[model samples]
Target: MAEFWERYAEININDRQRKVLNKLLVADPDDFEGGISNKKHISMTNASSATATRDLKTPVETRMLVQSGGGRKARYGIDWVGITS
Candidate 1:
């Protein structure tokens, strides 16, 4: 976890983004079968859809998360390789 945060030391991850990232870090793989959806992010962060959408972008841009699908099916997963390396 310390190493993971170190990788993003140069990125500015806000409270909501931090919350979601922490959740993802400790979450069971089964809980996120296809990664985290916008709807799930909303539920976890108590953020509006627009806010969730915006918050999710930073990690993707920083290569912390990888996106998949589109629209209602869109999901995001921590880039294990990106961080591990």
Candidate 2:
């Protein structure tokens, strides 16, 4: 998620994206089923511009619901920051 916060944008994701992101947020990062394997993944592909990152300079909006710790760390709060609940 650090990579995303460094170069991400403010995106208002749709319904499907919300559901998928919700599932992936709390789930373990290493967990296979926890990733974006749900039906909502397609929506992410369709709306590439919404979440896709152009480069380090260009910001890309991601759907990260759960965030990390403090101390100069980056928190990816998808439902909270990326997309409003």
- Give the best candidate by TM-score: 1
Q: In model 2, what is the error at residue 3, expressed in angstroms?
A: 14
Per-residue lDDT of candidate 2, residues 1-85 (tens digit): 4444343336555555544444454456554232332123444445443342221011113334443443223333343454322
Model 1 lDDT, residue 16, Cα = 89
Off by over 4 Å in 1: 82-85
Q: List the pairs of residues colliding in candidate 1.
A: none
lDDT (tens digit, per residue) of candidate 1 on 3-61: 78888789998998998988888888999888999999999988999999999998998
Superposed Cα RMSD, model 1 = 1.5
Shift in Å, residue 52, candidate 1: 0.4
Worst 10 residues of 1 by lDDT: 76-85
- TM-score for each candidate, following the candidate numbering: 0.92, 0.30
